[model samples]
Target: MLTCVTRGLFIQLVFDCRRLRKMQPQQPGYSSSRAYLELIADLPWQKVSEERELDLRAAKESLDRDHYGLTKVKQRIIEYLAVRKLKPDARGPVLCFVGPPGVGKTSLATSIAKALNRKFIRISLGGVKDEADIRGHRRTYIGSMPGRLIDGLKRVSVNNPVMLLDEIDKTGSDVRGDPASALLEVLDPEQNKTFNDHYLNVPFDLSKVVFVATANRMQPIPPALLDRMEVIELPGYTPEEKLKIAMKHLLPRVLEQHGLSSAYLQIPEAVVKLIIERYTREAGVRNLERNLAALARAAAVKVAELDSTLRLGKEMQPITTTLLDSRLADGGEVEMEVIPMGQDISNTYENPSPMIVDEAMLEKVLGPPRFDDREAADRVSSPGVSVGLVWTSFGGEVQFVEATAMAGKGDLHLTGQLGDVIKESAQLALTWVRARSADLNLSPTSDINILESRDIHIHFPAGAVPKDGPSAGVTLVTSLVSLFSNRKVRADTAMTGEMTLRGLVLPVGGVKDKVLAAHRYGIKRVILPERNLKDLAEIPAPILAGIEILLVKRIEEVLGHAFENGFPLRLHSSL
Candidate 1:
């Protein structure tokens, strides 16, 4: 059955199909025309999932039930639901969850659908480079179908289901066209009311559909497309958060999925802590969850083997037959009978013991610890090496900058898949250090520049992985200072900031992620630009409590905080 709008279109098409009487079923365009008609008939023009009354308390409970932590994100979701409850017809801004993988971005969108009692559909836009993927190819093209939106509506048989455009940042532009541009109309509240698809050849009413999107980063999303949505940033989980999630959500769920119970497979809290610290180093609990699942699988295999052995033993149990003398005496007939020993049978079977996950077991199943916190201390033990923090798509990571000097034409060499911004920052750091060589007491003689007689080479390890950004500015300078002074920076300290040619430090982005990275690496102290103190408020108090944060406004202060012995300036200097 078609709605009024579609019914009218169907009638018009029927009138135009009089030529079909002259054409055979095997004629050109016959199948496509027939498929188009079937699609029109099948589409849910007005059908909708009967939305249940919005219960804010129940919605909050649902969100909390499925996810742990994410207090800010949960609050934002509650507010969005509240707005929907207050004005059901209001055109609310599309919510776009931006976060690293395994941070529950997709699951939260699913929860919203459950809360609203709306049918849920996920349209994965990752690696979708063609515009046809969004708007559909024109009907003139053979084998064309409707866009993802229309096709999804047909699938759910609803005009107002909660639709998730997942991985929105992964879309790209090419000669075919930009899918992001096509999404502009679909996401825009004012324009989506009449969403047009090329194959459909008619505008579909998408105003009732509730759209939610997710992305790993916001930079790739078009500004115009991004403007139509409200972005909620979900940061990576702390160790404490990951532990709670593992114990409360991941473990039980994994065990049940593997057809085993905690009684059959036990993972102690200490073992889990070890997994978090040694086995995996990540911003999210995805790896942790996978490890837990692996343990569960191993335990399941053992349990299954035990069960099969018990079943084989039962099948092989010997039975002793005896003559029925009572029957022979009473009825004058003899019969052979097997005597059943109920109590004895119970004694022959024993319940299988649960498999416990321990450190040794972890090593066996997960191999040696993939990451070590002590690595930072060992790497920074020598002079000309310092730690810096930078953010990546996976989350924040600890970056080590190593600098050395050798005899050459005083040219600077930089390695490690660095970008232009970082290369420039390195040059700026070098220039700043060279200008302050005399004040820093680094000149061999009063008139000799530090780099005049030797070339400098700076290398960031993890050379295969691309590294960039200005946050490593101070780290580079500190490394150079350590190289010249032959004094090591504190192994326990890591710093991030942008430096100027005048020996001033500037604030940078991803301060929270950097701090988290430091925490993950067991770095006790972090040197951050003074301007980023406000950003620290977003970090959990527990994480901040464990690590000491030093805020600095200038490169001098950064150097002072970075080294165990203060970076002193000479009384007299060459200006």
Candidate 2:
């Protein structure tokens, strides 16, 4: 019995050793196991300390100090931290800041890291297509390596760092598999605890790491991936906010970079406002910053010239007296004096005036305004042309809807690269007008006869840009009405809303964005759906104060507000 037991034990021991050898990490020939062991030991585990109450206070201070505005975002982040402190076991919510480029989305992540006392790592997801980029390639493949998440952790030397995944919406997909789908696992709190990388082939804890994402447009982001994140919207700054940002953050940074000071170069608030309104019409201060840098560069050149002239003047002080005497000979010289090159013959050299960047200086520095609202306004002054508000990924813009009638087989032609939704909207508008021809007094003949007599051509000004969405329904209807009735749309009016076959106006999304776009174009009166009146509360008070908002529940109301003298109607014998 003892001999049999000994044999069995020997066999078991051999089997165990074979399994152990197979499980060992693969390495190049002639490399010792000690190197691999050292690498594992070198991997950083807990680089950041546990979240503490005091860190929250520090975080708020850091955020406020580094960033301007975004009060709501700051409060939301603080609330997140407070929740994290209360629930230590829970993973942090993945925050995705949606806004235009250069709006401090990436910078805010860095600020969050500084607040929490953690290392920061950023991975640009722009154009990242392969799934291997997120989950890592298998070691079986040559040139195999870990994914960005793992690499970021390795570089930071910590398991828990603030990782910012930027431009998530820009990620592409192909046969290689979707990187966005792979991110779902990494971003999920439940699955990330045992996150198994292909190369590592072992579970690595990623639950402690905090991930933040950013994107310019939300629609391009995969719905499944967006679901895992708590979205925070950062709208384009208002004129006042932009000015404050320029004065508080952008001005100082640009001035220091150009080696100039406020004492030497003075940019008044009025000049900043002019730059904001004319030179740059963006949601963020990126263009504004660039313009300021240009101004700074121009100012730097002047300063350098002034400095060089002063140096030259000091060197030629003795010669200056002789030159002044000779030059003053024609004017009857009373005394021999030396004047600086920066100063003329007058004594105005003692107190030099600061270079003021006014409207004229702005025009000189930035050339003419890139965006001319007057041209846009003039385009909509004629009949059959109406102003429509559109929300783009960059920001809000005013789109012109133009229509004209000609004698043909009643075919409706749409010239713009309009999508299915907008094409359908245009058709619906025509249908509603034809059905209600008697009520509208469109013509003495039947509605079908009127449409059959002439062909209508509708064109959106910018045919190159793809336009879609149902929000332009009201605008299209108003445009068609104005075309048939020979009435001009009010030049100061802009409209946005969806319309049903029954002439009922429906509310649309991006109300704030649309309103801001109208405000940017200097529209005095805006026609919006009655339901969207609630959304107006979110708009800036200053923007709302300037424009007249007419809330309408039906298409008739829109027509009333759109035209200077409502829709012209011809009296019928039945009336």
Which residue runs of candidate 2 sit more than 4 Å off their true CA positions?
Answer: 1-42, 49-52, 55-58, 308-353, 445-447, 568-575
TM for candidate 1 is: 0.93
> Which candidate has the top score in lDDT?
1
Candidate 2 residue-wise lDDT, 504-561, digit = tens: 9999978877787777777889999999988988798999899999999988889888
Q: Model-by-model lDDT, in order?
A: 0.89, 0.82
Candidate 2 Cα deviation (angstroms), residue 226: 1.8
The segments of candidate 1 whose C-alpha lies over 4 angstroms from its true place after superposition are 1-12, 16-22, 317-344, 444-447, 571-575
Clashes of 2: 0
Could you say which candidate leads in TM-score?
1
- Window of ten residues with lowest summed lDDT in model 1: 319-328
TM-score of each: 0.93, 0.84
For every candidate in turn, the CA RMSD to the true structure comes to: 3.7, 8.0
